[model samples]
Target: PPRKNSGVLADAMENMATFAALLRKEMNAHEDNDHEYRKLEIWTRGLISSLDELEQSWFAAAFYRKSVIAGFMDDMSPVEQGDYARYVYFYKDGFIRVFSLLDKLGTVLNHFYDLKTSKLKTHFSYFTVLRQLQLLNVHPALADQLEQIKNSYRDPLENLRKRRNAEIHYMNSEMQDDLWQRHQGLHDKIQLEDLDSHLEDLKQSLEMNCKTLIAAFSYSNEQLRKEISKPKSVQS
Candidate 1:
């Protein structure tokens, strides 16, 4: 059976579809020469509008949809209806949800960037691999990136936690942006290629990352298949 978080995951997946539509709308709406057009600086960025006010703008409609839709519903509960609701996502279990979302974002990022090696200084790849394998294992083979993710993003879980805490506590988006600068570097690397040939080396290197991700998960995917088949509680 699927896990209990299926609803949350489904809502997110549907929101991704909506997000894709928003991207296409924004792309078609913008003229190529427009200063604010989201140029193809990065694969995903190319999909977003150049407007800064539209952060996570793709889900804006789903965020406020009035009528409850069928499989596509992402309706928030009464607890999340108020302004102070942001804090609700910072509690014990709430934090895990937030982190899981980050891992998902990382998976999305993986689709757009070059091969990266994890350089986690504080922890070993084994633990990080297990966590990613369990939670955000979008590609069973993404486990190869686990070494890089763990090694390179040694303390991503903690760093993201701190950044999210500051954003929630101080009402400032600075620290978060600062952290994002590192990711922006990855995007910057993509633009160094010849714009005329239409292919960037970094863009081409994404295959390495995908191979790593797939291998990482496949390392243990078969053994876990049986465990998942039996009626069992989600250990995490």
Candidate 2:
């Protein structure tokens, strides 16, 4: 019943003494304490317990994202899984795996904007994703940046975006292969580059989006922190 820092409780099995002696020490140590020691002990216990729970939850989230990606990839055709929604989730989750952290849409937008490939199709049907992203408390300026980010392509993927969104959100089964080319609004074409590189870029951009969203949030947070840290005017 002693307080401990969970950070210090690390995964080192060697750090722990034998259980019997440790417990006996705790029992003896508790008997030596007064009211203040008991209070300090209570707070330390809470702090360590809370930290332990937080660490568990943190690792749990990492495991959950990886599991979701694995399940999603396993369920879809390699081609189908390469499409927008699943690929975005895959890369976003991947960004967390690589960076050891995440910041909402911060990582998402960064990857989108960071894309610079002209070796194949430069188009992306990002409207729905951006609209969804907009719901994550994006500012007008950030929205503008997101818009500019999506608008970099020579052609708009509005029809494709609509179809992808419908497929993802409405579970529409009709948006099947090569349907966009049949639509009048779309010149739906891709450059003659191999599909493998195209898919790789798609995934790379998704990962970059994860990083971009993080960058955007960091900027916003820095601004907020500056305001919070500013000195308050003296009261009259």
Say which candidate scores most in lDDT.
2
- Give lDDT tens digits, candidate 2, residues 138-183: 4556666656645553132233334345555765423343354346
Q: What TM-score would candidate 2 get against the native?
A: 0.29
Least well predicted 10-residue stretch by lDDT in candidate 1: 193-202
Across residues 143-202, which tens digit of lDDT does each residue of candidate 1 receive? 445546545533434543564577568754333443455477744322111211111211
Candidate 1, backbone clash total:
19
Per-candidate local distance difference test: 0.35, 0.37
Candidate 2 accuracy as lDDT: 0.37
Per-model RMSD to reference: 21.7, 17.6
Which residue runs does candidate 2 get wrong by more than 4 Å?
1-144, 153-163, 169-175, 178-201, 204-208, 232-236
